[model samples]
Target: MGSSRWIRPEIYPLFAATGVAVGICIAQLVRNITGNPEVRVTKENRAAGILENFDEGRKYRENPVRKFVRGRAPEIMPSINDFFSKPDL
Candidate 1:
């Protein structure tokens, strides 16, 4: 019983190391099978996409904010103009 007890403690570390190695192998196999590599977004490709969209008939004035601000022009401009207009005596 004494020799068996001495051997059991030494085997725990070997079991733990084997478990870790198995986990790493499984993770690598999953990565290989999925064929999904990490996506790398560089500034050059992002800027090129944006430039292409802008070049392909996308104008700043066509933006929703510009349309909305222009839509509110009559509401805002008339108020300011009314305030600054000469008051009749």
Candidate 2:
């Protein structure tokens, strides 16, 4: 029984883990083969994908807090460069 073959008792845990992973993969494959249905985005669910995507297009628009902080300065950041840039005056 002390003779070391291809499979060792010390490596049993690794074998078990590999078996579990293989089983999970096989389960996923079977599920895929059986046609796992996709979920459709609904308007009532407050679908985030489109809005989140389009929101990036609104990055130039000033936010309320930004408007409060910089007032008209936030709107002019991209166009005008030298404003009240004095360090000591």
Candidate 3:
């Protein structure tokens, strides 16, 4: 059958390699079009010190809600290693 011929295991690696190559090419094309080539230094930016730049970058990186959640660790699942390490009574 036509379907069985197309489903051969030997063809899978060729398909995977072609998919990866196409994905990389598309990503590079997108980055070339949208990515900035150089940083622009305005009068305000030039006047700003390292601490001011750091604060500005921090504000841009995350909002208040994200900042608050970042401090706490997620406890979705207990660690298996820690569970096994405890001495049984």
Instruction: Provide the TM-score for each candidate, comma-separated.
Output: 0.32, 0.36, 0.38
**By lDDT, who's the top model here?**
3
The better-scoring model by TM-score among 1 and 2 is 2
RMSD of 1: 21.3
For residues 17-82, what per-residue lDDT tens digits would candidate 1 score against the true structure? 999999999986774544322322565654554333433244532556667777465465786787
What TM-score would candidate 1 get against the native? 0.32
Better by TM-score, candidate 3 or 2: 3
| Selected candidate, larger TM-score, 1 vs 3 | 3
Which regions of candidate 2 fall more than 4 Å away from where they truly are?
A: 1-3, 37-89
lDDT of 2 by residue, 1-89 (tens): 54576678889999999999999999767745443223224555445433444453344344456567873655557434555563545
Q: Which candidate order results from sorting by TM-score in descending order?
A: 3, 2, 1
Where's the lowest-lDDT run of ten residues in candidate 2?
32-41
Clashing pairs in 3: none
